[model samples]
Target: MAAVLLTGTGVTWTYVASGGHRFDVADAPDAPVAVVFGAETKTPYLTGRLETTIALVKAGKVRSVLVSGNAAGSSGNETRAMTSYLLTHGVPMAEVVVDPYGVDTYDTCARAVQVYGLRRALLVTQPYHLPRAVSLCRSLGMDADGVNAQCACGGVNLFVNEAREWFATVLALKNAIWHRAPGVASLPH
Candidate 1:
């Protein structure tokens, strides 16, 4: 158990560290799409990501914004809320796309490549999550770079997010290598 933990820690650190200078939307690479993975709708983390993406859109840094999140059909559609927020906030509706199937970061990364047809993209998310999220998206064959949004959630929320990210980093690494399935072609017709 100790060896496993140590190895996971080492791998995680190496991967995350590769993106050490990642921060802020100003430094993000210009891509056709800014892929903003979803979190709590009203949380500063998600909202800030949206705001950054919107600014990027207005600045002509990116041509479109892809808001990826939980669909949960009509009952729990985070994508709907996110799309609505982006549209209301001055992002052109034609430029605000949603990935309703992106229930998690891994799914978001994969779908961005397969479903959304993104070869290169700018990823936006909270700072604590930027490293792993950027790492996973890149490993999944996206020419992906990232910018961390400023987060306002704290205390237990912060602790839980960082803690969950540790294990999630490991899983993301695994999926990075072995997640090939029917892929985008297999989606229901």
Candidate 2:
């Protein structure tokens, strides 16, 4: 029992340590393309993350920024709203691209890999959300890194979100193995 407990604790620590999130962009050469996934519409944490990614684009670290998120409403697309916000903040409109159908993490990574032909990316989201996103992206063949949004929602939100990620991870893995759509490779540009 003690051994089991210790092993579980170690595993938990590894996940937590990897999930704390880091925003400082690492060095990249040649492969400067990135895809920034969107968060909730009005969350400061999400907006702050979008801004950081835009700054990277503005600084020329990212040559292309693929904005993927909910874009179903008539009022505005979340990804487009993010792009517009970035443009207002000095990121060129030409640098921004949109994936209008990415309503979830699995779908977002799928779109990035299949539709955009993403070979690598810096997955940006909150700390608690990073591990699943990075893991899923990598599972789909993206040489993925992570950058974090600010953690303004506190510890309880973190705990709940992390718990939710376990289910997400399982679902994503299953989908990747058994439920993936055909023709992802042959889709026309």
Best by lDDT: 1
Model 2: per-residue Cα lDDT over 74-150, one tens digit each: 33467767778778888777877888777778788888888889987777777666766766677677777777655
What is the C-alpha local distance difference test score of candidate 1?
0.76
lDDT of 1 by residue, 1-189 (tens): 975795487466636644554656776667898899888666777778888788778778899889888766333467777888888988888888878778778888888888878988888888778887788777777888787777667999889988777677776667767885422212233
By TM-score, who's the top model here?
1
Candidate 2 at 119: error in angstroms? 1.0
How well does candidate 1 score on lDDT at residue 3? 50
lDDT of each: 0.76, 0.67
Clashing pairs in 1: none
